[model samples]
Target: MFDLDRWLEIFQTINKNKLRTLLAGFTVTLGILIFTVLFGMGNGLKNTFYTFFQDDAQNTIFIYPGFATKPFKGFKENRRIEFKNEDLALLEEKFGDRIEFTTARISKGTTVKYKSEYGNYTVRAVHPEHQYLEKTIIDRGRFINENDIEKDTRVATIGRLVEKDLFGNENAVGKYFTLNKIVYRVVGVFSDEGGDREERNIYTPVSTTQLIYKNTDKIDQINLSYDMAIGANGARRLSRDIKKVLKDKHNIAPSDRNGIYVESVIEDLEQNLQLANVLQIIVFWIGLGTLFAGVIGISNIMVYIVKERTKELGIRKALGAKPSTVIGMILQETMVITMIFGYIGLLIGNFVLNSMGNKLEDWFITNPNVSQGTIIFATVILILSGLIAGYIPARRAARVKPIVALRDE
Candidate 1:
């Protein structure tokens, strides 16, 4: 098992053709490196998508009006559909127990001013239940309450960014801000959201926004939260029921080609996650194909090396070396070269991923690291490739007749 002389001979042969050996080894190494990097990037993208989806309630549904694509009830195509306050009230009456929270929204992009400081931002009119649907945590004070909605108070909640820009470190509550020259008292400051879009909004009661903006009966959107106790399938069924009700009330057919649009966040997220998994599998196969090509190259090179070294092998056999001993020497050499270079490639790939992963994550890309399972799997593949590449050439050499091998120049 411990044949120092055999190993020395193998090393000396490789040393004589250092450049050629290195080139072959490098090809295999680079293939593995590319594979590792690509696989890591795929995983990272999957993680990023999953993280963003996690921030919102999985069972939430959004409803908005869009242009009708087909005529309905004598109305021409391209008619604008609009939802109203009464529609939201009707849905709540019918599905109150099944729904966790419901909110009607009317929003506009307008400039908000506090004293001398001003910023352009979106303002939304919402009910107290909007907080339950969004489940957003407040950093200071509290969100809108039922009293504010009932009395149509002119109080507002400002996002963290707005507070910082207008009031600096000072307490924002009790400060007055103006939108469209109408003043409203700031009642609360919302928490920062890592620069999420919602962090720039200014929120007030639906009734107050209607009165001030002079669009009292119109609403831009409606958001609903279904009880998690309902389960995902049940939530989906409830969404369909709600959609059916809206279509019927609006005098639109159930199969109307153009009508109100209902979007289920859960369904969208599930579809996206499935797509991400498929993409990861595709990336893995591409990387493996590249690595397989490299293994084939190594196998061909080893075959050539053995053919060229037939005379040396014949001399060894003539000196009483067993067939197993000759095979072991060649296998050992191949494995050593593969393990050393393969590991170097793995380290280099990991280093590159680590350096870029954080920057990508900041931009909302997820994990971005190759999993331990994948790395272990790759290592096994490398070893097996090396053994197979070496075994074929070694076996051919072992079968050669010493007389014939020695006859060659």
Candidate 2:
């Protein structure tokens, strides 16, 4: 089935018409290149969305105290709402089954000193379950435990950066650090995917912080992760129920939305995810449109090429060449050009993306890439476009009378 003569002739024609062939090839190449890069950047944007939320658990919810705007039950408007250790207990007692992990947060910034090295860092007061809530990974030793909370022990779990700052190359476990002139032994060294900022804090027992700082049971915020089995709707219902309970318990007005701010991570996550999906769809269409433009460009070029070779085609037909042979020649040439240029475009696009690395992270494009399936599909589309583009003009040329085509200027 392989015709060496016909293929050699096709090559000879391509060789003789370098400028025209280059122009056709350029159109195809440019189209696929643009499509590849655009789709890759779209994927990069989606990656940014996911990476942004990776620092915290997706099922987590944060409850921050806010001032009441309306008066109720002798309580005045503008009253500051404060969460206590009892609030955490109340949630556990009420929604024990619905909750997975709960923690009361007390954040304080203080200068930490170990030996000759020292740095100012935040001290996060938390329960053992805070590890899951913050996605903390213990690299050495252990996180804060129940006994540490119960005993109000003067101990802390230091962040990786904190250890680096205060201890240099020395391991921080079992070491002592001074915070506010009070000595606390480090029990663990931890890391976070949240980068350097998150890894610069020190974690201690909530009870210990309450006793040392203000000598009260006051907490800054409440954070918890719900059981994943409780779907998004269930999380919303639970959020509403929590707000109502906290409102009624604090004697705030029923309609007071500002008194208790319950933020559901899943809600924001779902919305952003929807946005990411929409962007991808838009990108896909944009890429498809670019590809269509290339197909059109090549189609036009094929028509022009046939017009230029009209007399030559007529002579071949007069010399006993079949109409199918004429069609085949044009189709074969188009295919060869399209395939070579399309593959070149794909390679160049991928190389550009790879070379970018994380340099475009500021633009929310991380590791932009097109999948193998997409590459194959695009290649197939280009080949088919070539066939169709060449077929139309080739068929018109074949249908012309030898005398009429010969008379063409």
Give per-model TM-scores.
0.88, 0.92
Q: What are the RMSDs of all candidates, in order?
A: 2.9, 2.3
Strongest candidate by lDDT? 2
Give the Cα error of residue 209 in candidate 1, in Å. Answer: 1.5
Off by over 4 Å in 1: 1-17, 73-77, 96-98, 192-196, 229-232, 319-325, 358-367
Q: Show the lowest summed lDDT stretch of 10 residues, model 1.
A: 191-200
Model 1 agreement with the true structure over 1-409: per-residue lDDT tens digits: 4678766876787789998789768878987999999899888888877676765677788888877667667777776889889989998999999988899988888888888999899998998888766666688888888898888899999888888888888899988889878899999988643355777888899988887766567899999988889887887898788888887777675676458888787887878878888988999999998888887888788888888889988998999989998898888888877877888888988998888856877755565789899999999999998898789999999999898889877
Clashes of 2: 0
lDDT of 2 by residue, 19-100 (tens): 9999999988998999999989888888887888899998999998899999889889999999998999999999999999
Q: What TM-score does candidate 1 reach?
A: 0.88
Model 2 pairs whose backbones collide: none
Error of 1 at 38 (Å): 1.1
> What's the TM for model 2?
0.92
